[model samples]
Target: MSTVPLIRGYEVVIGLETHAQLSTRSKIFSGASTQFGAEPNTQACPVDLALPGTLPVMNRGAVERAIRFGLAVGAKVAPQSIFARKNYFYPDLPKGYQISQYEIPVVQGGKVGFFVGDHRKTVNLTRAHLEEDAGKSLHEDYHGQTGIDLNRAGTPLLEIVSEPEMRSSAEAVEYAKALHALVVWLGICDGNMQEGSFRCDANVSVRRPGQPYGTRREIKNLNSFRFLQQAIDYEVQWQIEQIEDGLPIVQATVLFNPDTGETRSMRTKEDAHDYRYFPDPDLPPLVIDPAWVEQVKAAMPELPSTMAERFQQEDGLPAYDATMMTQSLAMARFYEAARDASGQPKLVANWLMGEVSRRLNTEGGSIEASPVAAGTLAALIGRIVDGTVSNNGARQVFDALWGGDTDVDAVIEAKGLKQMNDEGALAAIVDQVLAANAKSVDEYRAGKDKAFNALVGQVMKASKGKANPAQAGELLKKKLG
Candidate 1:
């Protein structure tokens, strides 16, 4: 049996609550535009402002997006779900109470699976509910008084709550990334954590191996995954130290300061009763029809898990490569296009994971934004397969392709990248290598493998890198015998 990872003799339990802002064009309860970066109060409708005579009308697009998320996660879309008013007062909230889902959320009970290192981990989701986002309080731009940006207010959000199943910060980040990818894959959200399109709150605690659960402190608004991991680790250590010194852990809502790498208590964590949730009178019960669910499902794209399985069974890729390829929808489509064009699955996986991913990361770009087209990459890989270019030659062609040159064969010719595969020419060079490196040949004949590799390198160097490395190695072995 596998053991849970312990930090300083304490098992860390982490639960994550992620908010994926729906990519609707309008607010959840009003006709105000939901576009970000708008001027404060410019986008706030009367309903968002909670004016005297305003009532919120539900956005069908927002509910459809929630249905999309639910179908993507295999969660049950409650045929009849009610919205409730969660009583709270803050500078950013125009209304004294916020409309949210309390007991009957729209999406209920799902599992998110992701790989942490080599181990596949899964976290159970408690519920995902539809709600309106609170406005942003801006303090930096104003001199003494804070300004409120109600543009984000009334924006649609699907608040996904997870069970306390993650044991380490790594698992939590992986789960967050998987869910982020899923939402982006489903086109429900943009998955931009930096822009606040998606955010996560981590509930963390530490306990000894068989003891009752420790008190959990909620870390609010971990906007980045890096911060999410750092905050949880720091909070776990602090809690363990407190317990070691015979001090009790207090439950509270905390904020992670990325600069200090520490968590500061914000307020005492509020329980359900503290919020005083009651069904909202302004909004009626959200009733989704079974046919609507089917329509959404029919339009849904294939999920990552299903695509990964197909990559494994049909393309003969390993689980790791399959998972990596399915990290995003665009990447999966790119890999499939290249693999089908080249008729090489493993080679396509290697190139994408190695050269393609490395180049994209170095430039801080995404696969969707890559300059090398799938068909172009396929052509380059095809050249390598047909012995038209060596592996090094393929890299040269790929570089040229990324730099805006499209014709693979033309680039190969201009760069003198075609491998020297002619039998007579390569055999003559192999003979020269064998004759010049008698000592190395003796070592290889006497069973040293490194000497054989050295001889192969010398032959390639002699041929000015035109000789195919594999062909040289085979010919060199034949000549030695």
Candidate 2:
């Protein structure tokens, strides 16, 4: 029997802090454009630039979005939450202090469940709050001096904080991915890591069972899955080495170097007292009515977990296949189309997992941008099910269907690809194949198993693969014996 790996009584404790930029068209405090990839400072307005005599105004859409996310995660939405001031001195922070929810957050005390190693693990969420993001500081030699980009300033971000429930770097990474999927499905964040819409920071520490946790370190240079895994792995080992030596690990902020595949300490980690956090009088507290929370809850779409279960039980898809399809909202819709068109859920699962995904991944195309429409693909599958085309012939028909050359019926008729399931025609081809391969025929008569396959191949080739394989196999056996 295989055994699960252990860490010699040392458990890795992890927590994730994920920040996602909302998808609204305008910034949180001003009507300035929230569009990314614009010229530096072009998207800035008086509110975003922190000009004198400017006041902050909350965006209604941003609040409605936050409540939607809170309900999706089963979090408790506080009827009244206060926005506090977090003071800091960074060039990126034009306001010199960020408007954020500190003590009483908007949503609190929820749990997210995921499966790890044949069991279910629930990660406790401490709180999720809405906050305005700081502007980006660009350090480049374009004009031989550091520059600034206020385009991202004043953007609304949902900061999700989870309790220390993860036991490995892998589990922490999985939890991050789960959150990523939920937010994307909710249409709140775009989940574009390359463009910095979604960012993750992991807090890692080592602890003995029934003992207090060690001094934890935070890593921020990881954004993608591969880098997340590598950074956590490096940090855990580094913590272990520090404890093993006489040196105790210190609490601090750290940066990960993807090039070096290691994490280095940036500065001593600061406590809340270090920032001197106080309520910003300039901005009022956030208030949400209970009725508004109910409104947002009722508007949520079908989440992944619920949809996957329905697909497995109602649509008769395997658990693995259903999980894969529902992981992406777009892919799930495509699978439903295949099922709706053919009414053959099992057959649709096979084609989706095998051919459709293969072509999409090969061409760097998504299901939304596919040249083959879902309804058209469904029509092609129906032709295969009705014996209008053999398996090999189905590929050609699909190519034509997607290539703008012909529809399903046109491809079927143009290539003469209808299956010849008649016993009379199959028997004739089987007889001719056995007589031509007399050596293999004699070997099959003497109980040689491989010889049966050689004769079957010849029968298929003789009919140009339009022959029904099952009928041809039976007829070939009768003629050889």
Residue lDDT tens for model 2, 195-264: 8889898999987766898899999746787788899889988888788786988899999999999999
Pull out the clashing pairs in model 2. Answer: 252-269
Q: Write the per-residue lDDT of candidate 1 for residues 1-481, one digit (tens) a residue.
A: 5489888888999999999999999989999998777766899888998899899999999999999988877789999999999998898998988889999999999899889988888788899999999998888968988998888889999999999999999999999999999999999999988889999999999988998999999999999888999999899989999999999888899999999999999999999999999999999999999999999999999999999999999999999899999999999999999998999999999999999999998998889988988988899889999999999889988898889999999999999988999989999988888889999989998999999999999988999999999989888877777
- Candidate 2 runs further than 4 Å off: 1-13, 49-54, 111-122, 142-144, 167-174, 206-214, 233-248, 259-261, 396-406, 412-418, 432-458, 461-464, 474-481
Q: In order, what is each prediction's RMSD in angstroms?
A: 1.8, 3.8
Count residue pairs with overlapping backbones in model 2.
1
Identify the runs in model 1 with alpha carbons over 4 angstroms from their true place.
none
lDDT measured at residue 379 in model 2 versus the true structure, 0 to 100: 83
lDDT of each: 0.92, 0.83
Instruction: Tell me, by TM-score, which candidate is best.
Output: 1
**Alpha-carbon shift of residue 192 in model 1 (angstroms):** 2.5
